[model samples]
Target chain A: MQGDFYQLLKEQGYVLGMSGQAGVGQALTTATTILAFKYRDGVLVAGDRRATAGNMVMYDRTDKVLEIDRHSVMAIAGVPATAYEMVRILEHSFKYYRRTQLQELSFEGKLRALSKLLKENVPAALAGTGAVVPIFAGYDAEQESAKIYFYDILGAEFEGVEYAVSGSGSPTIRGILHYVNTWGEQPLSAMSEEQAAVQALRLLTSAAEFDSATGGVNREAGLYPVVKLITPNGVTAMADPHLRSLFESNVSKGS
Target chain B: MYEEPYRWVEAVGNRRQYLDAQFAQGSPVVGVSCDQGILLMTMSKGTPKLYEIYDRLALGGMGHPADLEKLRFTLLEMAHVEGFNRSASDVTGSRLIKYGIAPVVKQAFEEVFKAPFIAKLLLGELGQKAGKDGFLTINYDGVFEEKNRYAVLAASSSVEQRMVEYLRPQSCVSLKDAVDLAIHAWAIGDRAQRHTDDTGGDPKDGKGSSDQPVADSQTLMTHIRQCMQGKSIECVLLDRHVAGTSKYRTLGSGELETLLPKDLSSALT
Candidate 1:
């Protein structure tokens, strides 16, 4: 009868799924890694391209650094499906808010939205389900400096003082970040492409060296890219050639 | 042997000075009605080719600066022959301008020779043509449509067109090429935004700004084609029409395209 006037499918009793739980047709949770550090120019986020389901690798080459606003970039890790969907939802929300509210939303406001999305997906995340943990950063127009924020599955948000790391490679990425040599917003108007290229390589290589879950630099494929966000300007991905050149420079310098 | 059949003749006077004929009191300003729906009339045409885009301006009201805010929203959608016509009960009812109907001539000298803006005028005509640009009555008009065509510029509309920013996605094999393409796209986008509707959103808005839900990559390419012409073309007048009746053929639907930032860059080369 609901079908008679567009009723709920719930009464139809259509149940479906496999996996280890009531998976229905829903996607499985595959964890990924996202890491970020603030530079004098702007905030920089780096993410590895691998998403793992349990101990088994599910996908390689997934993007983690995402443009959140005109002046922000979010580095995320955790369930790829949930994180991907969450980012889309946040983008739409940002646009709606930006238009309705003449004032741009705050960085904390962005974190709050992420928290809600993650909270909504918590039930699945707890039951062999997957969750998304993200480390976000953006240039705060009010403060005139880059700010960092973090969020958990239950909508808990925290602002880390120095830097933040989340996802599969968090432990390893965080460990190396201790020796990153730098963190903090600056007076510069922007981060040159070269500087961004260098920073992204540093974060990705740190994970590649210690964490098996994170993929090494992808110099060619356009898909599953990494990006950097500086001040005033939005997030930007160094092109393949530039990334390759940076990697080569790193190798030569290391030797 | 000396005379060529398919030769060009110099157009009489200056086509750029189409609006120079003494605008005394409330006379019509010479300008092209662009699809972007902005006022792009030439203020001066000399060394740099100056054009003023009227973002908002009107002829009525007690003349107060505070009204600018309200007019900003109205100009966002209004244009000539296509300007908004709301009844007295409409949102900004009192701000409506009343005027007479006249055939703003397309310059007699434009014919008998070649116009510097033949291509551009024809391109605009490819989009929309023929509508009221005068005044309307005060009433609680229902859903506005072709049914409500008689309307003039509200006092809130500033004459200067706002500039829009744009981005171009360059499909490049090398990074250098990509950067170059991106920059080229910027130049084109900047030119269009500055020369036309300065108020249009940035090029990044892309399909979002178009009335038609421009989904595929092709429609953007068409938009790019029209943008580069620089002049607001009205009709593609053929030789017979131009010489005899000052007539032109209406461009059918799907006749023109919108170019993306990247598409414009490709054409630049």
Candidate 2:
């Protein structure tokens, strides 16, 4: 069963029309904007809930943030189907390593594993039908600290010193994060998990304001960006009500 | 280059019997349900037999090392696959054992693969509802029985006898009592005398250790220290009360020391 399932999935394929050699003519309508940062308690991972198909919003409650394991999470920013299959494959691979080895993989090991997965999908990525860019964040038990890793389509792993953001709206979010870090009295790492989560939501809201692909917190439908806190305690998604209040509070403050 | 013909041929032997014989030499695993949650204790001679199947689910195996590894691997893959296929709230220890491992082991027994895994399993998981934690004892041959209080695997007859004798008919037990009873069961192999040293409670009384349990956590910790002299014991607790992320964790020596009756810092010395 090792890599057998992945091989089977490879045979099935993600893009309905594309084959091994053909490239997707147009970009896939996809979710955008995933931001992660290390704070005092742990790493905060966030993503907007909107999935856009071209100019039209395909889904408003799409979840781009996925829990990879108990301690780690990944945010997908391309080809929803490919992203899901990749997550499943990675999740199975991580658990397989833990089972056979009887120990969890190191943070570096996890990054390498993700890299391998992305590298294997290089052909599909080149075909443009199966591209997935992800931001990974987790609490490293051995190092006793929160860590964040970003990956390109080619699966090049890059460790972010303070924060990492991905997808089309990343530029906007990154700009805001830079502004916050430079203007704030303390480094981003000094902020609490709650503060970091709030900052992430605010940044995503701003991204949604400027970028059509990103979705803002919708008070009417009660949908909010998915926010997860990966603390020493464990990885948990912030409750909708909490995110709602944060949105309301932030909105109450004038621009 | 010459390739060995029939390389996949399994050596002719009683594989099931051989697997069981290996378990005879494997470590003892004891699981007990207490007020705090479920406590799973096992001796580690280097290689670990305990595994976290999920955030709340865990499995402890005692059998052929290869078979144990296979079982652990298959079980975890099934769990994660099942979890990914359904909602997270749908996955549970009992469900994994009942619907997941049970089928795999059943197939293994049917010789779906090379040979059946010779691994007895003790599974513990935090309950979906608060205070509903579960513990299950599974035979290597796919037979399983749900134990409310406690269960033991690959142990001396006396240890099994003591567990059945001490925990039967009890509705609930405290974490301290569970730890003491599990260790006491494991320690029974060394202590040949049948006398109840802690509080003189009759060994056969079937009163359930929690009925008039003599040892407090501290006293039991000391007793455990005395029993485990010159030995390192691996302990895990699936605490239901643990809020946030994961409810299962291995107890560190430092934390275990804090639970001891006295500073047994030099007890082994």
Candidate 3:
């Protein structure tokens, strides 16, 4: 039925995944995100709690994104339109081809879909940067395993080195991810949240330290970092309150 | 792929024969051999029950086989005498057919049982527990867990990795649950022995059997009972630990037939 609704939208020429599910957290769900590493057993996906309107932080409490389906999520940023449209397309695709399709999409499929959409939106994406980038993660039933995906402005998808990073601050986020992946290892499940938080904080703080666009949650204490985790169970939004102590540790260490 | 080269089919056929023999001898020890894996039809397609299980597995199968939920649901359907998995046969074909039980009789067996049920047994829970690392020690009634879809065993070794198998119930009377499970254990055990001989796991000193049940059911004890369900054997020498543990529990000298009818007991005894 919703497929029928989405099909109608597609024929009308509006992108399918851009319709945001507004709720307590994300307004349009045009978001920024990261996921935990793929451990020997599984993988985790994470996101920062920030939505931006170009330079302005449109919503801080926003979840950046949420799980459209349980095991995986479509976390996006850039134009909220791109974010919501991608989610709708994927969500509907899963519903329609569910029985026949395996659990997770191939890393290539993940990127190709984004690329096709991004390439389709050549007008806006090239103009003022309404380009969308998203990260997809889940267990692939056929592969009988887990994987993560990251996309760029032109719809270029990358199976990130370890962690997947997308959004305005991704270059900076990518730095945080690199440091975490190096220390925490690609599959983050083996480590505790504290280790992960520390990795994330250090990265966010490091990103915020240099990249003005990226800040940990404690923007004043000097690092404002908010992070989320996507594990086998599903998405977990790490609050700023919890982030404070970890952020404080790094601050004190520097002091 | 359609014809499934004779070697592969025979490998599976051997496993079915082993279970059939186990039943014929009234012996509980059975060995299952498979190339890829077997699909046990648990229930008919499109039922709300199967749908719920499939949905659950979709969300939960991260680290393990998510198919088991559907297996359980299929079993539930079979127990209730429901038709099952038309999609499976129409598509999967002979690959789906290798599993011990047949689809046509699944509902009949399930109807006899009446609680319609299905199960997917992972290979890990099939073998012995605790060795050098002390990490495998466990205590539970059933030697294995009827895990959700997230926990299917995929290892292809009898040395360390056990086998994961599925079951289809012919009726809801709970009639074939034990038999089907026993046949599955038989397949795994035999596969482990042949696997060890093939891989050199030195099963006697290693985990006792290369092809242990993925469920790790203390095969020596529980699965021995499982392996020799309707027969006249003592304890299945399936695992030394199970044999020794039974002695500790002061259970009889493993005179299995004493637990059942003499006439039927002689079949395997």
Query: By the TM-score metric, which is better: model 2 or model 3?
Result: 2
Docking class of 3: incorrect
For every model shown, the clashing-pair count is 35, 0, 87
Q: Tens digits of per-residue lDDT for model 3 on A57-169?
A: 66655444546555566666566655565665555344333332323444345445556766666555555435576676665555555667776666666675456666556
Per-residue C-alpha lDDT of model 1 across residues A212-250, encoded as one tens digit per residue: 777766545543337565567655666666666667776
Q: Which stretches of candidate 1 lie over 4 Å from their true place?
A: A1-29, A54-58, A182-196, A219-225, A252-255, B1-269
TM-score of each: 0.46, 0.73, 0.41
RMSD of each: 20.9, 7.8, 17.9
lDDT of 2 by residue, A25-71 (tens): 56477759999987888888999988887788989998888987888
Q: Model 1 chain B, TM? A: 0.18
Estimate, for each residue in B2-62, the C-alpha lDDT of model 2 and write its tens digit: 1333332342224443554454445667777777877888767667677777767778877
Candidate closer to the true structure by lDDT (higher is better), 1 or 2: 2
- What is the C-alpha local distance difference test score of candidate 2? 0.71
Interface RMSD of 2: 3.9
DockQ, every prediction: 0.01, 0.31, 0.01
Tell me chain A's TM-score in each of the predictions.
0.76, 0.90, 0.67
lDDT of each: 0.41, 0.71, 0.40
Ten-residue region with minimum lDDT total, candidate 1 chain B? B117-126
Task: List runs of model 3 lying over 4 Å from the truth.
Answer: A1-41, A99-112, A173-191, A219-226, A232-255, B1-269
